[model samples]
Target: MAVRNADISVRRGEVIAITGQSGSGKSSLLYCLAGVLPVARGEVRFDGRVLGALDDEELSALRRERFGFVFQYGELLPELTVEENTALPLRLAGQRKGEALATAGAVLSRLGLGELRQRRPSQVSGGQSQRVAVARALVHQPAVVFADEPTGSLDSANATAVLEEFLTLARSQGTAVVLVTHDADVAGRADTHYRMRDGMLAPFTRDAS
Candidate 1:
């Protein structure tokens, strides 16, 4: 999807949900803001620095050191154990193996997956896998997290469970989140909601509920 114009501000610890159908430019806007994709027009700024202005190294460093991402599928590495996967971002950032795994274990415990940390992605249920993904995204205590259709693959009960934990952890750590989903129930969980259609964005209201 081509995102022509998308402008929004996300404050510290804020949860912003953008609801749009597939091909409605939701992911485009998200990747643009996360600095994964460059905007064609206008600018995307994080902490007063224009993303486009940053050189490749600077951008790479910024993304590595400060940003986090979670996709619809949880995208856990099938080869890695849950603990290993959750500790990956920290590992990539050069933290010691023991320290990273310990931290990951703590996060997994908090999310009620302590025992399952040793299990591989293929061994866990869909919801548990997504929680592991959330654990990974929050393990680094990033400035912001970008989640795309985070609960889209789960049943309603599992979806609610994962969403609640995701929001609770992010808010407690003062980490802002930008969530893009097609589900209204999930969108309503956000502090602010926006509707995206044909690449246009608008505030959503209860009347539209």
Candidate 2:
């Protein structure tokens, strides 16, 4: 199925929510924007940089340096401690072990996971593990964060906690957040919202009688 063209701009320190039913092209839009999927048409830009013009290597570098991603699943390494998992991106960027771990420590602290840094993913609760995923994504201090169903597996309270943390981090660090979710409560928390239907996205509107 062909995905529809979307022209969207997200500024610093704002949270933008993308909501749609399953198979509505929400995830496809994200993948296209992130350069994970090739765009047959249309263009994506970030902070004035044209994404479509970049080669794969260039896109990878840009993504590494300028973007963070949180998948629905934690995607943590089984053998790594929370701290190690959180430090992966920094390490990938060529920071020394000490520096990467330090950065991870700070991010974990910010996410309220400092006390559990030494534990493995299997040793923590689902919510705590997901928090570690959030820390990992933010450790590199990217300009934009893309999250796909970030709270999809959590309980109500846990989902709320994670959503609030995402908003707080974006606000405090001046990072732009683009989140994909089916949850209305999660969508409602965003600064701006868009809903996808039949492969097109439109601004969310509420009826006031």
Candidate 3:
């Protein structure tokens, strides 16, 4: 099994972090919790609703409406402008273009990307592109955000800046954040920290050696 008996919970506006070595099943646990992967046993619940009980359409709708994701690579569509990419989630959730764009613009501004809204992802620096990705994940104000290696590609300075902005915005809006990374410094910033080893998940502390 990639992940075994992993169990955890997060509250509104709280930040949770999982740190583990490569192939230790950290991503597997994150995907299961996000409903992106099926649980072979046990279950995942969101807002009192069992994720396994929902049909695919229902699950898709739920995710689109209430969840967000950030990846190590930013994953912004190169063909789309920064603002358009940020607005994509709201658009997919049925918001009007005008309103979605306006909302996206606002988020981009808050993330210090207002002036670059019209630029494409390829036109920005790695740090700027990552910030745009953060803006996209947050534009919809989802109840939860799942981030995997969100800052693994950047230098320490850029990583710190992006993470600070990401958490500040999420916390301000009462959104829960689940982050997976191998960086101990990053994990230490979370309200709760867990370490995965050989497919098992367990609580972590600074004193743990």
Candidate 4:
């Protein structure tokens, strides 16, 4: 799935949705923009720097220091406690264990998981685990969060809760969001929505709901 001529420009603190069927290249475009995948031809610029031109170490630093991510599954470590799992990014970025855990605890509290900090990922419900994932993603307050099918595994109510929390945090922190989903409701919640087809993206039109 190769994306060509993609000209997406996400504004600060904006919520942008990209919707498509499975294997429609939506995630590929995201990976390219995020610097996870190499841009074969065109340039991917972030904060006015060309991602393709950056060296490996610089790219790694950029991702570590400026970006956040959420996936379809919570992807929390099974052995680590919820707090530890949420703080893993900070820990990897050289934060002390005590301070990382403290920050993680505060973010968890904001996500309504203050009481479940000691539990492992397997010990929590799916919805709770996903909320924890959200906490982990935003704990570092990255410039942008790239969420791919973030609420796909949850039921409607839980999905709503997760999306609401994401929006609230993004609004308060002025972080941007790039959400990829096939669900209309999920896409509808974003300020701007586009449908991906054959490696191309076009504006999404709302139908009577």
| Candidate 1 positional error at 192, Å | 0.7
Count: clashes, candidate 2: 0
Clash number for each model? 0, 0, 0, 0
lDDT of 4 by residue, 118-202 (tens): 9989889999999999999888889999998999999999999999998898768889999999899888899999888788877
**Tens-place lDDT digits, model 2, residues 26-134:** 9998888787888887778776777888888899998898889999988999999999999999988889999899989988998888999899999999998888988
lDDT of each: 0.93, 0.88, 0.94, 0.91
lDDT (tens digit, per residue) of candidate 1 on 9-76: 99999999998778989898999999999887999999999999999999998888898899999999
Q: Please rank every candidate by lDDT, starting with the best.
A: 3, 1, 4, 2
Highest lDDT, which number? 3
Name the better of 3 and 4 by lDDT.
Answer: 3
Better of 1 and 4 by lDDT: 1
What tens-digit string does per-residue lDDT give for candidate 3 at 1-209?
Answer: 38998989989999999988899999999999999999998999999999999999999998899999999999999999999999999999999999999999999999999999999998999999999999899889999999999999999999999999999999999999999999988988899999998999999956652
Error of 1 at 171 (Å): 0.3
- Model 3: weakest 10-residue lDDT segment is 200-209
Error of 3 at 5 (Å): 1.1
